[model samples]
Target: MPRLADKRRAILRGALTVFAREGYTRASIDQIAREAGVSTRTIYNHVADKSALFETVIQESAARVAEAQVEAMDRHLGGAVPDLREALVAFARDHARPTDADHFALVRQIQAEVGHIPEAALDSWQDTGPRRVQRAVEAHLARFMAEGRLRTADPHRAARHLVLLAAGEVTSRSFHGALPLPAKEVDAIVEDGVEVFLRAYAP
Candidate 1:
């Protein structure tokens, strides 16, 4: 028999892959068990049920993604995201590498499944990944404008554009299964995007 710790780790990794690919509803404990090369009894020993296992995967992935995004922003700033284009580029490029697929895909599945489970969706959204960068960007822009680094008349308008710039490509890909994008090509896009953005908001 596998050690308790080994079995648990196996379950975790297996669940992550299944969630990211098959989604929450379709991802079964049996499938996860098969993927882990363990038995269903092993998964149940670690997590009470499929829902519990789903939450566990989401929480772990969200924490990692949030940490990386926060760290990228922190490196760009002493403590705050002050400039518009710089912050947009930082957010996009950092998150664009696509870490924590299980957590992200699980959150997406949970949100879609929430309508079917009234009481459970509340906890699901509260615990899972969120589209929080929009509000964070708005707050940062407002602060910089207040201090005069930027001269934007509408922080909201700026926030919309920033979100589009950061997430548009990845969002499109998620729907269409990743398009043809190489690393150098992506970098070129980001570079030109920054120039265009600066021109639109330059002082």
Candidate 2:
């Protein structure tokens, strides 16, 4: 038998895929349970309701993306880049891959369905929502600032721009129904962005 925690994780992952392919209003717990390979009762035992499960899945996804992004950002910090542009190339290339890109899709899904959810769901969604991803970027940038690799006057504000330049652009592309840009193109964008950012923000 699978461990309860492991089973719950499976269910959450399955539910997230379904929720992304569908939406909160249309997604069914029965489908989620089926995808999770657990009975409906088991899903309920693990989560309060569909909304609760959605919140959990979304937060978990956010956490996953945060870890990867923070790690990738650190790679640029320690390397001997000729200038900010080279450092940014690595930064953008790191995110250009398809790994866990679904989390961002989940973020878009939440924005689409937030109004339909209850106050509790809304609160959970907002607190650990895509907003936390922004905070994570801030924390990572602050680390670079502490190491003297970055010269931002305010890490928090600067992080907001970085997040917008990176993830925000990808998120915006969805609005236009455009496919994800190539990884190399993303690197160029980041390289250019870093150049511009350094003009005003870097020390």
Candidate 3:
């Protein structure tokens, strides 16, 4: 059972790389098998088909991205910060950054293939990824509101506001992560975002 689980994980990792590079239409089981260092028959033993594999990959990758985002929120917002602005800037920086090179590649791949992929796959990704991140941010904002650190009538709205303020310009200027912004530039954007958020939500 352990060996089977390890092979499945290996196949998923390799599939991510191939799918990211070649995209859904071009990605082949044989290529994924080679990338995984497993036989094509072995891959077939794990997943029923390419579509199944792709869906699983999307879900797994989304979970990983969501985990990283939630962790960032907890790190910057869960605990006490001497300076809210500075802490928020740090959070924004982390939020904007990709979890890793492979994760970045998978994100780009998803964007590239979004129009081509199944609606179910897209929904799965959104449910596991962005929605989860939004919930985490909302929970953090609710905590701040309860503590009287922020004056928010609606914690959900405030969370959305903060996320948009922090991410909008950076995402646009970065071309949705296609272009990498330098650390200093990211910090500047986050600083401005935090200022705007404070103007709206601070007590």
Candidate 4:
């Protein structure tokens, strides 16, 4: 069972690499099999087809990204801070930064193939990734509201505003992770966004 689990993980990792390198339409199961160092039969045994594999990869990758973002929120907002603005800027910086090469590549692939992928897969990605990240941020903001550190009637809306303000411009300029932004530029963007967020929400 352990060996089987390891093989499945390897296949998933390999599939992600292939899918990211070659968008879903061009990625082949044989390529994934070679990258995984497993047989095509093993790949088939785990997933029904390429579509299913793609769905699995997106779901898994999205979960990871959501987890990372939530962790960033917690790290910066989980405890008391003497300077809310600074802490928020820190969180914004971390949140906007790319998680990993594979993750970034996968994001690029999603943007490239958004029209070609199944609707269900896109929905799943949204639920697992963006929505989950937003909810996590909302929960953190709600804690601040309860503590009287921030003033927002709607935590969800505030969360969305903060996220948009922090990521909107940088992400657009980066072309959804296809282009990398310089560290100094990302810091400037996050700091500016957090400043705007504080203007509206700070207590």
lDDT of each: 0.65, 0.69, 0.84, 0.87
TM-score of 1: 0.69
Indicate the residue-level lDDT of 37 in model 2: 89
> Per-residue CA lDDT of candidate 2, range 1-203, in tens?
47988998889888988888788888999998888888999998888888789878877776676667667766775445456556665665565444664665665666787788667666665566446656655776676677677784687789777656654565465441236776566666666666666665665
Per-candidate RMSD, Å: 4.3, 3.3, 1.8, 1.6
List of clashing residue pairs for candidate 1:
none
lDDT per residue for candidate 1 within 1-203, as digits (tens), equals 46887888888889888977787767899999999999998788788898788777766666566666666655654365545566657666665555555566665665566664335534544544344444455666676667676666587777566545655565555532234367665555665665665566655
Worst 10 residues of 2 by lDDT: 169-178
Score every model by TM-score: 0.69, 0.78, 0.91, 0.92
Q: In candidate 4, where is summed lDDT lowest over 10 consecutive residues?
A: 95-104
Angstrom error of the Cα, residue 199, model 2: value is: 1.2
Ranking by TM-score: 4, 3, 2, 1
Model 1 lDDT vs. the true structure? 0.65
Q: Could you give candidate 3's per-residue lDDT for residues 9-127 as a string of tens digits?
A: 99999999998888888899999999999999999998999988988998898898889889877898887877777778878888876656665667677787678887887788789
* Ranking of models by lDDT: 4, 3, 2, 1
- Error (Å) of candidate 3 at residue 23 is 1.6
Q: lDDT tens digits, residues 146-187, model 4?
A: 888899569999988997898777877886656879889998
